[model samples]
Target chain A: MKTTIHLKLYAGLQKYASASDDNHPIETGDSVREVLNRLGVPPDKPLLVFINGNRSKATSLLQGEELVKVFPPMRGG
Target chain B: MNSFIGKMLNVDLTSGKIETVSIPTEWAEKYTGQKGLGTRILMEDLDPKTDPLSPQNKIVMTSSIMAGTIVSCSAKLAIATKSPQTGTITDGSIGGHAGAELKYAGYDAICISGKAEELSYLYLDPDKAEIRSAAELKGVGTFETEIRIKEMAGDPQVKVLANGPAGENQVLFSCISTERYRQLGRGGIGAVMGSKNLKAVAIRGWLDVHVPDMKECLKVAKELHAADKIDDAEYEIYTDGTPILVDFSQESGLLPTDNFQEGTFEGFEKINSASMKEVRAAKKACFSCAIACGNYLKGSKSDVEGPEYETIALCGSSIRNDSRDRIIEINSICDDVGLDTISAGAVIAYMMEMTEKGLHDFGIRFGETEKAVEMVRKIAFKEGVGAEGAMGTKKLADKYGGAEFAMHVKGMEIPGYDPRGSWAMGLAYVSAPRGGCHMSAYPIEAEAWGDLDPYTYEGKADLVVGLQNSQFAKFSMGVCDFWPVASDNLAKLYSVTYGGKWTAEEVDIIGERIFNLQRIFNIMAGFDGGDDKLPGRFHQENLKSGPPKDISMPEEAFMKSMQEYYRLRGWDDKGKPTLEKLKALGVEDRFVQQYETYLATS
Candidate 1:
């Protein structure tokens, strides 16, 4: 079954996502990496990825209705 | 005397005596300038085991050979002292008109020793020096102190380095504020200044730096300017300042959130560069900085200088709060209180974690902006529980039973990035001479740049070591890191300005030597391989998000990487420089023998 994953950017990464891109969705079957690849987001970017409030890697298979968030390099003191 | 002012001003606060001493030509040639020269002076004069806050612990403020010259991004100064936080050599750099003024005032450095019996401010003009009573300036914040000093000096051109209540209270992470917002922020340098009972230092000058080859130097400056303009990605940094990293860090999941329990924040957009531009009243510039990154943001209540990357991350995302206005207010509070924002935020975050775990009664709920502001003020004034908070993160965590979650390296609070997420930064923090610093070796650039895999730990060791070496060189030269000039370009600039044949390789060698020297200092201070470690949380807690989900940094792999790093650095198994390596670097046998004796005992 096909699952839809929601992607959100935090802190400085919001520059890459405008109002039009809010709550942007990407499709994947199971793995998070496949979803990122399908969404055209480069995995090489300094992205901290979270799946459903827990830290997960791109290789981790996704469950349906997972809340996925990506962030850039933090500048906070 | 071609590049240097040839003299150093020694101020004895105990006796109110001020003397000008000629700098030895041999010392200048051996140590170069700024951090290098400052370290050499400290090693020669002060005992290695001297108490950091004692009157005997000298505060060496020095400018580089390039400073005050018509060189790009030379408006930098180094404040070197035994760190109260780390108990090791610490040097913090600040960018402003002050370093230039000092160089123009015909001095390469100012050596301050001993403590004043009463509060005082030093006004150093080009020809005269005075230690005046600072009765009126007592209890004043850095911003107010700067304004008052400018007014009192009767010269608006004077550059003032001032401390706030945090310093007066001897907060372990208190910073010296210069050019209003720019800080010599790490290692409690302000506490050292405060211990001296020095309220402020105001300097003014009209002399110029005599460049050996002005035409060639100017050509290089023009090239640097051109390069800055053409590089669209880097050039944008000039417009937005460091807040630009807010979005980048947030997206990368590197932004520390909820006391670094998670890597991502929910409300990053409200605190990023776009929001900053929306809130700022005007853009500001430091002395001779081509890229004016300083933002003067006006909130409803006050007009503050910034909510830079560290401030925004620590005050904003780290708490799961995204209000730019609140962040700006807190940033202003830190500036006014003369506190380091990074440490302040870390302490608050530690408190939040404690509160969440039922460890203590802090009354600080996560995302409570008002409480955050209140706590910042209280910490500054050392009021009630704020006293513990002002002592810094490690101390606060120790007061409660939260050593595992203190989020500090070498006693100083860690910056915004959670090391478990980024291995290179973790290494940088673990091995950072001044403790838990991002700027010492910002591996984030290498980690983020190009089509390389950011999540993989492959090839990070070499990049981190190289960057650390280069950053040491930058610190030695006393140049602001914002300048895009590479080491090669800098070598050419140095060659032209100093009338010396400085190749890029020679520059790298100097950097390596400085890095090793710093390592030796830390080693001599009793920091061993055991101290080169992360907090328990980083090693044990698994990352819940990102590409490396549920993967905690394996200590074995990390230790191996460190060993490889040491080997690459020409050090022994215990992370000390080998005899052959020391001899090759031209380090005298006396230092080597002393270090060996210390190592054997430790």
Candidate 2:
């Protein structure tokens, strides 16, 4: 059976995301890094990943988190 | 064969002496232009011990080498002066047509000295410059000052930089307004203009700015535009402007809420990008800019060019006020009155906390929108409670007794980011040459919004130093901060316009040299490692909610990181750059000797 987790992509990563990008289906043991690769983001791109509003590593395994946010490098005030 | 324009203007307001001076060939190559060039000139013009608001103080304004070229985002100017607020060597970069106009008017920079005998404005054109009486423009807001100066010039296209009632009153954080919407908006540079009895600068120029080759310049500019479009895919500034930071700051627990007593705001959703989009009236850009990051919003009560992230965070969550309309109204008032929103919002928030804690009665509670709006005008006009508020946080804290939670580094109030969540940002704030300026070295891009660990002290020293050096170099080029142009592209840009082969490493070294120059100036002005510090709040207080909850930057770890930062910059334990390091960086022998003398005597 597949588990679902909420996903939000920001900045230029929005181009890779669709409206259905939210509530994405994933395998129970999938890593955050793996999910991003599936979504077509460049493998080497640095990202800020947060799971349930807490800073999470890209290699952290997912367990049907309530929400996840991913963003490319951005700088401004 | 370069974009130097070959000359600068020296205006002595007291004696009414307007002289055209040739730019030195050696200084041009050594310092480049803009912030770097301006600092080099400023170092030689006035003494470090000169009173910031006295007639002895001097103001240096520089046009970037890229200004008036086909370079994108090149409409930036640098203003350097000793800050009346912080008593540090402060420089601010402003975006507008004025810098480009300076280039077209056949000048690379302007050095204004001495006080005007009466209230006056400087009018400049290709032929001549005159100091004209501005007694009729007295007590006017910045918005009207710009319009009236243009009308007086009989040229609607005349670029103007004007100060308002706040500047005339010499409010410590008053800003100089340009293009009606943009400002050189930190460290009380406007107060310096006010102290000189200078009201505005009205400039009109039609002379052609030179380049090595016009055809190659255009071709290179086209390529750069294309590259910016492709490389800046992650920059949502054009669409969402700075309001995009509202959501990111909220999620990362970096937003300054309730005078930084907390990191999260319950009403944050009300002022984020999505909400801003609902009222977005128009988008604007600086001269020669393609990205056009300026967003104009129209709310029911007011319309303004911005309440950008800093304004929204500092005026919105920092004050515990969530009304977008109210924020817009406050932003409009501050812009017109020529007050810096960052300092104004931070001061108001400080007073609110003081009031809530029963230390003082400022008559405004947290989240009082109407009272905050009233205070903007009061601070500008210096009325009632505005008198003390206009003096800024450090002075108020000194008088009213709440230094621990004053929320400033040096005397300048901290901008939006709460450093507790992003640990390197704490270092950035404490170590910034200009005091509490996020633009000096923004670590938030790496820590809060990128891949770096936000809660650790490790590796922060290197990150902050690198960012500061790069930022100083970029500002020297007069490029907008929004464009994430690589060092390779910067080298390409220099080669195209100036007919010189520039390596990426050379550009990097220029950045390091400029940073060290400013540090030398600050040290000469009597700042030491002891002056580089965060307020007591960051070390002692913890946020009550969100990801950064119960987290305060550990004082010992932070001090260690700061020392490491100094070491990385080749400064001594007291944060003074050694003479050997200066000689290695090719800093002038005069500055090194001046610094040496200052160290021994002080």
Candidate 3:
């Protein structure tokens, strides 16, 4: 049986989603990098990524229902 | 004796006359330097209602006191004039070696007035100034023009600011290209120059920058540079340049796709930062900058400076072209043709919209790279259908009867960031004296990262006001925005650089004064509260994707923010500065009296 996790995006990284809300699901037991890869999110796209609001490495393991968020570099005055 | 070169060179291109005047001490004290001083000088000389493209309009280029000094990122030049685009006061700041070279040439500013009878260029050395006929140099691109001028001057160090075919043809959005790549890219400064029949200004000098205290300045600069590295956001900008924002904006649903019809583009990944990194050949640096964020990308034919964040956003996703190589080509062409990337892209996007709606048949389609290239060349040359499009987005949109989706404010095309995606930026766009500008205030940093909710309209009024004030101060100092200057540090830099004892509060007061003065200039030019508005689409359209899906900017919220902003600015409901505010800033009684009359009627 396959489990699913939720993902959120902030700032410039929100464009990768087909949906409007921040509750997209990813396959469980996948690493953060794997999840992004599956969703067509490039690994080098974001400067920082977060899991459940905490900064996490791309290789970090993901569990079902885990909330992942990603942010890109800021470019405003 | 300190900081400034202490002279202004006035060149009458028509008569081939050159004159030098001593810099007024009192004026320097009041206006600070660069943008502020340039505006004050321009206001004294030109009538507010005069046509911007007329020969009577002055093209004043001023360097700040810190420009040639070892002050961090102080190599900025301000180009000020009545704007052909907005019909109001406008100035564009460009980062390059030209301003510093001008300072070294023993002038704080170069003020050029009167129309030349024929093509001409100003050649300046440390000890001499001459007006030379530019017949031989006509029809050259900016890069070639700069190289030719340097060859003529017999110095590789000679800095040149010139126009390309776009400016030569008086394209309304044409830019004054400086140091080959850097540009005074807004409000059609190049068109103003072109109208004067001025082709270029080349200068070389060996004079040193005079600093009051070199050791103290160096110490502060080192500390600021160090702090900038630790600031992850600033650090990334240094490494990746602005193209890094491409991925984020795409993912965040603020990429401005299909003439801003959609919030995101499908082909974003192919043209983003990672791809840019793969093609980047070397890093480039501007004068006195530590962060060296500029990247030189190797093209199949030639190496070119990057399509930065603004370029990528405007020329790529905004128009649905996702090929990085094509974007790079577009960027190089804009530079060569001397057109602003933002305005050019906006105009092209408008053309695409017109084509899609069957308004005209110009063979422009989304993702048509070859057509885009041809259009750029045609616009530069003012040939065929490109002639109408060359007039800029506002005029082109008006011609096509699509002013509703033009995405311009005060006749200038807006930048890449969609206002509906960022309310404070939207307000900044409308109220900016120069029209549709991002440099006045960038609220995205605070809006995204501050404790306040990014989606909420609450407290955005204060946020926009603060950012505007700070940006004014930054420009007055003539430094790059990438510096890590907190309020306290900025106050210190101002005091030390100008010999004025300024607290952060005092600096903020100066900022408020400059901002209000610019507003007064615009008001006198006939813009008012009603003119302070965004495009209809931003106010009505819903985001088709992203977290803010189905979200449209609320008119009521925007109005409330405007009200709060006006109140905070001490301006009345009509957006006129209050008498008390002017008096508090020590503005002269004569101007204050005139403002009072305007306010009473308003």
- How closely does chain A match the true chain A in each prediction, as TM-score? 0.61, 0.88, 0.70
Task: Give a tens-digit lDDT track for model 1, residues A1-77.
Answer: 55555666544444555412434455445666565565555656545556665555667776566777655433222
Residue lDDT tens for model 1, B150-199: 89888888999998878887888899897678788588888988899988
Q: Worst ten-residue run, lDDT, model 2 chain B?
A: B227-236
Order the numbered candidates by DockQ, best leading.
2, 3, 1
Candidate No. with top TM-score: 2
Q: Which structure among the candidates has the greatest DockQ?
A: 2
Residue B72 in candidate 2, Cα distance off native in Å? 0.9
DockQ of 1: 0.11
For each candidate, the alpha-carbon lDDT, in order, equals: 0.77, 0.87, 0.77
lDDT of 2 by residue, B1-602 (tens): 24877688999999999999988877766777898899988998678878999988888989888998889897698899999999998899888799998888888889998899888999988898999999999999999999998888889999999998998999999998988889885999989999999999887878877788889889988897787773354567876788888888998888899999999999998998778888998989888988778888998887898889999999999999899999999998888888989999999999999999999999988998899999999999899999999999999999999999998988999999999989999998888888999988888887777777788989999998888877877788888888877677887887787668888788878889988998888888888999989989999998877788899999999999988998999999988899999989999898888888887888
Q: For candidate 3, list the clashing residue pairs, or say none.
A: A12-B248, A12-B249, A12-B252, A13-B251, A13-B252, A14-B251, A14-B252, A15-B250, A15-B251, A15-B252
Choose 2 or 3, whichever is better by DockQ. 2
Chain A only, candidate 3, TM-score: 0.70
Worst lDDT run of 10 residues, candidate 3 chain B, spans B227-236
